[model samples]
Target chain A: MSDYKLDYLDQLESESIHIMREVAGQFERPALLFSGGKDSIVLVHLALKAFRPGKFPFPLVHIDTGHNFKEALEYRDNLAEEIGERLIVRNVEDTIKLKHLAEPKGKFASRNALQTYTLLDTIEEFKFDACIGGARRDEEKARAKERIFSVRDEFGQWNPKLQRPELWSIYNGKIDKGENVRVFPISNWTELDIWNYIKRENIKLPSIYFAHKREVIEHEGQFVAMSKFVLIEPTDKISVRKVRYRTVGDMTCTAAVESNATKIDDIINEIIATKTSERGETRIDDQVSEAAMEDRKKNGYF
Target chain B: MDILRFITAGSVDDGKSTLIGRLLYDSKSIMIDHLEAIERQTKNRDDGEIDLALLTDGLRAEREQGITIDVAYKYFSTPKRKFIIADAPGHIQYTRNMVTGASNSELIIILVDARHGVIEQTRRHSIIASLLNIPHVVVAVNKMDLVEYSEEVYNNILKDYDSLAGQLGLKNVTYIPISALNGDNIVDASQLLPWYKGDTLLNYLENVSLADDINLTNARFPVQYVIRPQTEQLHDYRGYAGKVISGIYKVGDAVTILPSGESSRISMIELGGKKVKEAFAPQSVVIHLRHDVDVSRGDVIVKDEDIPLIEQQIEVLLCWMDNKPLIAGNKYLLQINSSRVRCVVKTIDYKLNVNTLEKDLSPDKAGLNDIIRATIKTAQPIAYDSYQKLRVNGGAILIDETSNVTVGACMIQ
Candidate 1:
């Protein structure tokens, strides 16, 4: 390899850093949406690389669904504290109560959709013009069609058909009042890419990403962790299994894969050898419909 | 493995989506669940066979209408390279989408049906591939099975395309015969076309030389942010954070900050918070100067010897992207890299006809998807280079002031 050539990981890191700085240079009140997931964790790491020596220009905002894994929540808090960045957490529970919104009632009822309400509310509350996300195009088809700097309307609705033509690295973050842009700095990174980068940088992740013994209910060959958020059925068969989360989401909706991988290398190897996609293997919310993600994005769910 | 970003352009009838699907499937990048989802969708349709086109048609409306509405990016990697495919819609109405996709792609695969050799769609796509100055072009003669894999049909289309490429000044054009539906000459060489001896589409993509495409001589680093750590321990630390879009920067190199024309010497370079002796093109690094200068975001840091143009008036090939028509004296915000200035479209010299490459000098206004040669005068002098020479510094976007939408794409000349 030539000395001038950048490794793929370095290329990805540089691209992401450029984008994060674009957000910093473009928006007035921008926020980095930290979900405590691996992708978002990687986003924070890139932010450190992009704006270090100086503090992050924006605050880290999390719209907590109230059904998240305790480990992830703690990790989110610790990561923010260690980096000395401001973290603002808004709860879906508060939004649900204040807005008199109905809770989703079902087995494994998820607050994933409800989190969008809190997210939009938080955006309005902070008047954030740009919300930096870690959404990768490889995650879903709808996301694949989305531009790096995605513009959303006053209602935070994403119009996939009418997306502005984003050309080259020149991002247009110009938006009218009440409108905002959702910038995905890591839009090009794949799930495996994220794991590989995490390994390369030795970035810290929550313990739930590794193997642990947890009581889980098996549904259609998928393991749903036994948490209070899940509605226990009389006929449900629950057992303790050594498993690791492929993706971290609301505990009610995120499924775990049976694994004994404890280290980052082990996780990378598993991802490389796995036949299913990251969302397919773990996200219970996406399997609801063919256009589940698209529908959610249209209605202002990032 | 390194990365290869490319775009696939063709009309719906040309099997562009199927080619992308075949590439992903053959590369084993398609997860089992994604395959199953598409398989289920295919089973619901009229064709009993799995429809690969369903994979690229991402939106519900696109799936329902059986057309790609926007550019959907797809990722796949072989042992040799990681690939990012910008699957853009190819209809004339969606020309803007193709331009958007082509802007970032290093290579473009223009699919032409064997039965209808070198049609208008093929010509239009070739014109775009030239206008965007994409480094590589692959003329994929798809559906060779329809013509019985005849060498005559393939050669005829190849000959016609070679001339079209010549007309557009498209270099590094590679032609291949294939059947995307049957997966011939895509991942592996096809036995049917025994007379053909070129590399398969995947093999060529994996081995194409992209290192030379990056210009390493003209240094252009547009500062995106200034990192000022005013903390007690590091009170004097100040760094210009940005990506080196082109060329190289070494410690102690004399640099010039533009628009302001301030001069300084690089004291230190930091890559990912670590001090580095030198940083090359496309690396995001924090550059610290030996002496303090009036440098901030939108300032271009360059080697003092090779400075770019700092001009207020410039000619550009403008692609109107918004639904609103573009007219003379239209004021918009023109942004090139980190530098943005209010600008007015002085005049539309001529419209470049996409289909025939004709220059319509009498065009009154440019509507959506129209490409025209226009002159723009910026409120402030912005540093740039000719798009043909330095794409990183030359390409810009015009934002509509009132709507705050990206209304036009400009390739500075």
Candidate 2:
């Protein structure tokens, strides 16, 4: 007989898988949000476990911000192809061209906030009732209050006060027409949990997550990678440094940390010793205020 | 690493939030920005020190009112274990929030004010925790400094709590005397309690064994969905995708599909794209059957040798969560595992008095946030074990058919 004890990781995995199945069984049409980030990659891997020996019941969807890392985009496409799954990519540039979004001033301004418009538009376009993302509670204070099955109104706004009560493993995914549920299977998994899972499962991720030499400029106490969309000031000096991204987002907003944790095990160890949070180091938007993520989430930014 | 999820419950002034804040702060879990934000908000307060309560009181309305109105989850990890602290409200009106927070917790920390030992609210919280089957209870006697760290006051509270614990049938009870404001015996043991030789709060949380919390005797697997990948690459693959609710399931174990009376053997257990020898409760995996049967979602897979009672009527302990009272003869959806069946309340056996631990048999209607024992009749025969036997299969939620909101949670008796 196989000994089956409830390890912390196993328990977390079970809960996440239960959530994923709930998403598939409850929603009319759901899509897995693939961002080529470590969290999203882990979500895809869990989805695969959710319906094993069978193709994923839901399609994989990616909201491209146009300023994505080329390596990340390449990795995303290759992963989708390798898994033989349908990949749907919606671009914010198209949304901007279509006059759905206003262009911001300065080249370094982020399309991170503007992606919400395109995301809602894609949900409307595809009539997806549920969009499963890899949002964790430990990421921010506001996110800490989020339900596993977060319900969004017709306008795609999240009212934390009015969320449905999720008890036990039972998730209420019922929603009115035009209203959708934003399902977060890994809502309970912390950054350390994700790193530990990735290390244990040997889940493949984009190369950007590992330490590599890249051209970067220090901006507002962050090492902003040198990209075509980034506007470098005359006083800013470009330097080459070995850095790894704790998070993957739009190149204009995502920052890198100086680290030598090239391997997954080393990265896990680094995360254990690192005092700064994944978002604390990489997400420039959250550095603004305590309620920044909360405000964005209210505005339908996943 | 061990994972401990505990709920902190007490009356409004019992320093529940302060205790949680102290734990988070002393554990070094609070970041610089979070600390700064708390500092800026509490600048005008009496003490120049940051009011740690402000960290968990997330809502603007709650912050302005200086009270916790909802459940706020706080996470912190020591070198020993990771902890998920559910900071539940203490107000009598928000009993639903307390129930929600304590539902999934393995431990309940009932905070008692040493100056006011074992108040009505403490009894209320302890009763609810016991009702929810929280295996462990930690009675944290707060504000020892106010009592001059008097051993007499601490012992008085402990004696009262022990009596209450005996009444509630709580076996594993630990008493720790500390002051949340002074930061004593929380993360670190205080010198004031040198005579006290019990484990510190963090130490107790780190070493608590939660492996037995999940029932592993009766195997219950509710099929969430049937996976039939009709593609040519893997044409003949038919797997039942769902989480193992209880017990260990091996590849060659003889299994029975409930409601269908079909028998089969597990051909394989696949988890995360890898074939495993066996699967158990809470692990989401796909199980391959030796025989192709007409199985779908809501159907349960159990051990062929040991089958559960398949019945249309069940008596359950229900906790009403909706604002509307639970009226008999009203149709509601009772969802267990993947099975959703229309059920009606046959009778309200008794309403539980949370504070006094008394059963009011005269109440015909279960009000909002009331824990009541009721008998329910379902439209279809559902497979289930007693709550004491299997929490996953025995536990269910009542959904209001009209609003589609989960109005209550039911545990089969």
- Highest DockQ: which candidate? 1
Q: Which 10-residue span in candidate 1 chain B carries the lowest summed lDDT?
A: B54-63
Inter-residue clash pairs, candidate 1? none
Superposition error at A219 for model 2 (Å): 2.3
lDDT of 1 by residue, B1-413 (tens): 89999999997689988898888888889899999988876776775888887667678877788677788899988778888999898999989999999999999999999999999999899998888999999999999999999999988888888888888899999998999999999998999999999999999999999998888989999999999989999899999999999999999999998999989999999998899999998999999999989998899999999999999999999899998899999999999999889999999999998999899998889999999999999999999999999989999999998988899999999
Q: For model 2 chain B, where is the 10-residue window of minimal lDDT?
A: B60-69
* Each prediction's number of clashing residue pairs: 0, 0
What is residue B179's positional error in candidate 2, in angstroms? 2.1
Error of 2 at A235 (Å): 3.7
lDDT of each: 0.92, 0.85
TM-score of each: 0.99, 0.95
User: Candidate 2: which docking quality band?
Assistant: medium
Classify candidate 1 by CAPRI docking class: high
